[model samples]
Target: MNDYVRGSAWRVPVTACQPRPLSAFLSRNAQRRPASAIRSLLPLEQEPGMISLLAGKPNPATFPIEEIAVKVRLPDDASSPVVVAVTGDRLQKALQYGPTAGTPALVDWLAQLTSSLHGRPLPAQSSDSTKPWQLAVGNGSQDLIVKAFEVILDSGDTALLQSPTYPGVLPALCVGQVNTVAVESDEAGIRADALERMLARWDVDEKTSSLARPKLLYMVPTASNPTGTSTSLDRKRALLRLARKYDFLLFEDDPYYHLSFEEATPSLFALDGQDSDHDQGRVLRFESLSKVMSAGLRIGFVAGPSVLVDAINKYTATSHLQVSGVSQCVAIAVLEQMGHRGFLQHAARTADFYRRRRDAFERIAHEILRAEPPVAEWTSPGGGMFLWLRLLLPLNANTAEGDSFALISTQARRAGVLAVPGVAFLASSGGTSTYVRVSFSLIGEEDTAEAFRRLRRVILDL
Candidate 1:
């Protein structure tokens, strides 16, 4: 139990961040991970005139499916649909086995998108130890996030995550036998002041005293899943400072980055070291196309230091290999037609759709749930697709505020409308909380008011 500081001198002039040594972060297993024999040679096949029998790629003549034509709707609802076709070499690559990292066209496009949006240079490659920051495509952000925890943390290692996190990521963290500690959150994501105070008293805090210091901190900075709250830019800078002060990388699982109701807030990835004046690769950003694009396509990516990304690539090589080449082909084809500006404009349109839905849902919710003796209350979300309600319930023995687990699952289910119980989002024992999460992403406006009334009945019945 020692401090994350060194000699009490933690300041650097505003300049290009010096890369932290790979040794500081990588786990023993990641260090020993062997390169895939065939995957390693896959890159060499691209050299000019390099006629060599290096790969066992199947001849395309033996395969079926010649061309891929996908019908895409315009971002403007008024515009007619257009068809995007992938043919010739592009189609061949789509049908054929591709690189382990991703289809070069798709991965490069994502890197360029990140550079444009985050205000960083395209993935830097250098002979120096400045471990180039790069992006690696994955089946989904979930796939890469699980693999990341495996690469950086060992069995006894600790990882801090904002409480009431996305429940889907919990199983992955649990599998590694890694300690997942909850840092209390607020209406605006992670409580930075509380986090700083907790870190400062790490050795003395009963919950963390005997455990390992955190190697990573997990957060869904924009539109956090269950909370439906987005962190402000100023708050983001404060969290970045803590990451710098306490030598831990921030795992920004941002599936809702593009779904923000307002202009997207700058991520920890972009502000990695703005406060500390050094960007030592403290942010490992996991981006997803699931929300904005088709979730079935399973397109997501990790944008961070090449050191961690290469480890993820190694995991990819051994696990699912890569995201569907055909999926990448379809996505990249549509993206190309849209171009960067068009793609962003389309995302904005998508955000607007959700924004309207959120407003309608909340308006109806407040009308019913807040009448007389209030049945529930919540902070309206700034972004994302959920309305997190604090269900007021009769106090019980274990919980000062009654739990939502039974009520949400049993009563709400019987009422013919169901929402996720707050207990599911928690990682600790006795998952008790007064919150329940409901989404406004799908239900039509016509059914919006009715849904809240049914929910109101269920809560009142309790």
Candidate 2:
């Protein structure tokens, strides 16, 4: 194996391995799935001067509403609100059943947005058989995540996941019965040395010898859900090298990408493009408008090699058919109104909002929990809505760490404060943790300090 200098932006040469065909990575069920009959006929509607009877799409003429107007609040000026109208042709397109891929205009808009944001150029239109990088919108980042798993994994396939990961994916992994291995993490997120040791000794190690090597690595690099830890740029580059060296695909679940309080690090998807030797197959980045825009809109997009995206779309064709057309239209309207620069400005403001909340919450936490002997310790999050706190409770006889499950689910709730027990985020079964995840996002500003006080009182009472 070749070694690359740490902290450098330089790319390491991957082992001389022939790229496998896209079909080889697909599950058995995906291989046999047929294209939707109605979706196939959608193209004929596009032909110029072609007036036709197609599938049972509703006529927009019969729809009730004349127009839909959205009042967008400008971050700079609260009094001066901009109203974006989605009416006439645009409204018609939204109301009717559309293609499985997503609304064309919205899709195009996001493709450009993603390309520009990530610094990866859109693949040129070509007749070549090999698929290049592209984007596909979904119901939300969660929807895309499930579909990405469906596209790649079969029953019993192993996946390497960061410990204390997002709980959302856990249910899906459970239902699929996929073998999940927990990779160790530090304050900077997944530790490179731990991951390297795991992979280096996978076949030989007694603990992993019985299991197959992981085909995928699922991670939330920015403001990781329960941990609220952001991986550094150097750490990201190191992980990308591991993915290439081990030949496993990376699922970059980065819904909080825009919520970073500090300068954003280049994403794995962006880094894949920077390398001259690589073809952007190593990372599938999932992004959502949920955090920045409206979660109810349920609009998210995944960008990566087209082969992987094509597979994801195949699953979407049967599952949701497409993201809600109305939602897509709404997203397009807002994005176009904001434009790229304005969209980024809004993101910065959103980040600032959370940063203030984090500061307020942490101040109270320090006053209440970090007193004499210090009942709790936590890393101040750089971004996202969560603050992960590890309590210094008495250690259990069976486990090295004290458990927070009872304290959170029972005591905290009884104290009129609620939080997710850190155990919920653990990737493996029977895991124990002394940590709890608290959200600073939804809590009222006035109640923020009191919530921590309540939590601290509960801990003290215990």
Candidate 3:
């Protein structure tokens, strides 16, 4: 495909910035991958007055299931749950096989949502044609992320991500024989200045010179997984500048974009257009419906350059085939009823729900852990489900900063409190950290106090 694949226009930011060619980044596997023969023709079956024969698609009539109904409560109201149902042609679409990209109805809705939210043009709406950008739905964001890693990075290639990164992406790296490199992160996520210093001296840096230049820089960006640190607009602009200058795609794994304590946080995907010189497709964003809707539904979508999105869809064709048809149908129906505005309203409610939990968690921690000189320190999350606590445990000579592994694992477990060891999130660190990640999403308001009380007792004993 050409670097600047011109696309037919749509109603959204129909003429966004031209994207840079991904030729430099695509793995050898992606370059040689041919289109799936059967899945390639799946779209033709949808055209008017066509499709008598296709693959061994089972008859929906034979399936005993008749309907899929979902009950959902309103964002503001707690009184009643509204029942959303899928039937007729929609039901048929749900029962049978689906297009490789996604159920058309769901994909269209997501495309529209992405375009409107991101201020980017609608990608040319077809599989056969090419465009600078496109969208593909997946089983979940993690599913699409794995495929992206497979398609983009080959053996011995390097993947750069923030220290204390999401553990989910680590396992995926094994497939590509990739080298994991961690850049330090502060309270606002990955430090752009630190990255700038490293990249400026890439060849001279003995530790990095042997490895290939990083083709992708992955980040959670908003309410980061273990740190709960969110980058501001200025911070994001600085990072985008770095991505532009460094010539690496920004792989934004932003499941919590809609779950912010404040207004909807614009993703790197949404902000790329604001930088005039920044290439539009340099930011490939993976978004999940799991945080806002249902995790078991296993629904997520990727929105970015068409070449990359297509690469992932091709992988999906051979793997899971497509996201659950019923899940897509159910999502489409619920979203159709809610509309775009209603969806945001629901997201606001979800954010507020977590925010309350965070507040209660913070208050309890302050009372128990901060009673004396303070047993631990943490930044209260702006959004998302976590509280990252930096415990002030007794320090050893080897770990001047202190280590939470033993304290959080053995000691804390014995004290009846559990949190993810900070080392689990680091790629290179030798399991040394004074940090532990706790979730404020599930615990009740009443239980917050005792949870910290247990931790305080553990700290005092040690």
Q: For candidate 2, lDDT tens digit of each residue in 1-462?
A: 344321211112334244455555676567777877777678788999998787887777899977788999766675799998899888888888887778888888888888887898866766323547878889999999998887787777778899888889988888887889898877887887888888888877898776656778999999888777888888889998888777678899999999998788898888988998864688999999999999999999998888778888878877778888888888899888888888888998899988998898888889888987678999998789988999888777967878999999998898898889989999987978899988989787568778878877887776
Model 3 scores a C-alpha lDDT of 0.80
* Model 3, position 272: C-alpha lDDT score: 82
lDDT, model 2: 0.82
**Candidate 1, run of 10 with poorest lDDT:** 7-16
lDDT of each: 0.81, 0.82, 0.80
How many clashes show up per model? 0, 0, 0
Instruction: For model 2, state the Cα shift of residue 39 in Å.
Output: 0.9
Off by over 4 Å in 3: 1-20, 76-78, 126-129, 263-265, 275-278
* C-alpha RMSD values across all candidates: 4.2, 5.0, 5.6
Cα error, residue 19 of model 1, in Å, equals: 8.9
Query: Which is the leading candidate under lDDT?
Result: 2
Candidate 2: pairs in clash: none
- Candidate 2, after superposition: displacement of residue 37 in Å? 1.7
